[model samples]
Target chain A: DAGITQSPRHKVTETGTPVTLRCHQTENHRYMYWYRQDPGHGLRLIHYSYGVKDTDKGEVSDGYSVSRSKTEDFLLTLESATSSQTSVYFCAIRTSDRSTDTQYFGPGTRLTVL
Target chain B: SQQGEEDPQALSIQEGENATMNCSYKTSINNLQWYRQNSGRGLVHLILIRSNEREKHSGRLRVTLDTSKKSSSLLITASRAADTASYFCATEPTGPGNTGKLIFGQGTTLQVKP
Candidate 1:
């Protein structure tokens, strides 16, 4: 479990609506990541934060934004949801402060846009 | 768009048989890591092999990295039904000021028959 939890385990929303997914970790990990898993595409990074208020875009960051106001929480927001944005979202945390990076993931949020 | 590509998009084997998955990357890397995702759940980190290391083992899992060939492989010995899941390989490139960003592969769907 790694003490990571994601909110809204499942959600169904209409296109053009705004959606926000929350990730909370009790481990006080330095790095947090948001990723989406889609069929055939596997998992693609959307956004990540190295520390509080230090977020960066990932490969698929066009329609998504993220925020981290505290070390324990990271939020991923879709300004305007689209059909293509429907996917299972995962939040990961890097447990290592050393050179080697190993990420532990949360349970995930399954979002569907219609 | 993806740095790593896994071979045999899908695999099926008996519980006692060994399952092997191969991953090939496009460029030089700092490390190669493997992850497993059960259906409808988040990914779980399995093993990681740095570019400097050839092989590493954890329990029944063995990971080998070939930086010269820009490839890696994951071997699960005496596979069990619980081993059935999707496996993905991710790469982190080497350089100064590295963000430790990981580019993931398409992944391989592994099925172990009981």
Candidate 2:
């Protein structure tokens, strides 16, 4: 998947548990994003990071948080998992070229909350 | 709230035929992008068309954007079974402090049968 890797490809967790998903990129792209995909909701952005230590919320940022301490790594944390959060999570890195304005995605992580 | 909405939630066609998908967005955008996702996989960036550009082509794929209509269309010529997948359109809104974030549509599922 475009040099982007998301850890814990599949996970089964219980409600109220804390979970953290990791996204790492080899290209050191400046922009990183976290998204969740559901059956009918399509893909909703959870959060995004433009630079190290710089992050902002997306349309669906509730119940989720993100951190980017370094250039290559972006982390998404679920403070308390809920059944509603069960879905496929994807990470993406925007291409460095401003003209192209394309994004490369990671393989994705499937999480099931029980 | 979703920024983009794709038409024809599901589509099926025979190989060698053509396939088309449409997406409409709510607001002005700097650029629009298309992505493809196979079952149980991450998304792959397909093509991007800037607001100023009306049309773009890549291999067997063609994309056209109409900023006045706030819509875009993707056409695949000579479709193959391997092209069966979900296609999504994402838009990067244009405005101050945009932060290069993308809003994606629910997607159109295409099934090209051989």
Candidate 3:
């Protein structure tokens, strides 16, 4: 499991509400990623952090934001949730020597917006 | 806006049969990785093949990369029921910068009947 845990394994929220998902890794991996899996779209990257306080947007980062205040915690927040934002979210970690990137994933969080 | 496309949206095979899935990417890649996802869980990294490598094998899994054709394939020999899951392909473009954040492909749902 790589010691990666995602909180709120399942959630149902109304549109226009704010939702936050937390990813915690006990292994202290250098890289953390946020991805959403939708039907027919596979999984799309939303945000990722290379290190603490070093975060970047992914392909689907439009309505999402992420923060990494500590080495073990990466937070993905939806400023205003939408129906389209409902999907299964996954967090992954990578530990490599600056090359040969192989990743480890967490058990996902399934979020539904109505 | 996906970088990769995996063939055969779904597949079904017997436990003793072999399973093969293909992936096609749009851009030159530094490496390609295959991952497996069980029902309602996060993905697990299966194998990785670098651009310089044409083919690699591990246990019952074999991965072949054709950079010129911008495609790759994953083959599992003597498939087991446990191999039933969704498989995804991710690519990292060949470059000097940080393109390590993997861009995933639409997955192939594989069902191995026992």
In order of appearance, the predictions have TM-scores of 0.96, 0.97, 0.96
Order the numbered candidates by DockQ, best leading. 2, 1, 3
What are the clashing pairs of model 2? Answer: none
For model 1, residues A53-113, the per-residue Cα lDDT tens digits are 9998889999999999999999999999999999999999987646557889999999999
Q: What level of docking quality does candidate 3 show? A: medium
RMSD per model, one decimal: 1.3, 1.0, 1.3
Per-residue lDDT tens digits for candidate 1, residues B2-100, read: 899999899999999999999999998989999998988888888888888999999999999988899999999999999999999999877665566
- Listed for every candidate in order, the interface RMSD values in angstroms are 1.1, 0.7, 1.2
lDDT of 3 by residue, B51-79 (tens): 99999998999999999899999999999
For candidate 3, list the clashing residue pairs, or say none.
B30-B94
Location of the lowest summed lDDT over 10 successive residues in candidate 3 chain A:
A94-103
Model 2 Cα lDDT, one tens digit per residue, A1-114 = 668999999999999999999999998789999999999888899999999999999889999999999999999999999999999999999884765888888999999999
Report DockQ per prediction, comma-separated. Answer: 0.77, 0.86, 0.76
User: Worst lDDT window (10 residues) for model 1 chain A?
Assistant: A94-103
Tens digits of per-residue lDDT for model 3 on A1-114? 889999999999999999999999999888899999999998899999988999988899999999999999999999999999999999999867644578889999999999
Chain A of model 1, TM-score against the native? 0.96
The numbered model that scores best in TM-score is 2
